[model samples]
Target: MGESEQKVAKEPTEETAEVTGATVATEVSALPAEAPAVLPKTPPKGSKSYELIFLVDAALPKEELDALIAKVQGIIEQREGIVENVRVSDVRRLAYEIKKRTHGVYVVVNFFLLPSQIAELERLLRLDERVLRHMVICTRSS
Candidate 1:
């Protein structure tokens, strides 16, 4: 063949197998044309239960604290979530001072919301100055 002319070989089918000095032929079909379907890794898009715990500056007055909690609740409500229960603890000393304060108010909240809305809720909490720390946990059904 010329330098510009290249040889192209076709793929071997299952019917043929090459031996050291002979050729053998059999009959079988090629590999499957498509892969099997796979299910989604997460549950379907819908309301899932969650728990939220947050710490706020202890020195703030009750009115300020209420407003702060309301802001969080509003975020959840805006995303079509229901705030089931809220528990606020009296000011207590922290293991270490935060934002130059020795005490903080601990708040626990249980709610139901779509999984897609959790990130936005966290972003709002992270941006609030009064909120010192926060954690969100998905609660599995019993």
Candidate 2:
């Protein structure tokens, strides 16, 4: 082919550029540059304090209850959480029956754990048959 014909063949036309997305790229490049987005700082992992309260069968012997509490503490420590305090209250009557039990022992634990690990901890608690009911709350604001 002649030099002019070769040039015409090699140069991309508007339809070819549009079909190949080259026109979109060029249009994007022609726009003004934008400043980088500023994201808010997040609290450090494992810095938040949380409170875990769980109820167990009131009929359980003291030794078994103690062991159960220790097991829960172990679960928290396994996830790199620090257990600050553990309070086991005397048997209390439940407002409503849970698992056909009207009485339960309430155990409260204060600990520091990563927010991401909270869901896993809850799942573990829910799966424990010994635990009649459980709830975790953030003890301190992030």
- The weakest ten consecutive residues by lDDT in model 2 span 18-27
The residue-by-residue lDDT of candidate 2 on 1-142, one tens digit each, is 6764322223323332311122332222222245376674444564698999999998987778777878888998888888877877767999999999999888889888888889999999999899998999998954
Best by lDDT: 1
> What would the TM-scores of all predictions be?
0.66, 0.66
Candidate 2: regions farther than 4 A off: 1-46
Tens digit per residue, CA lDDT, model 1, 14-128: 4322111124455443444364766533433578889999998888877788788788888988887888778888779999988898999898888888888999999989999
Query: In model 1, what are the clashing residue pairs, if there are any?
Result: none
- For candidate 1, the TM-score is 0.66
Candidate 2's displacement at residue 124, Å, is: 0.8
The alpha-carbon root-mean-square deviation between model 2 and the true structure, to one decimal in Å, is 22.2
Residue 11 lDDT in candidate 1: 55
lDDT of 1: 0.78
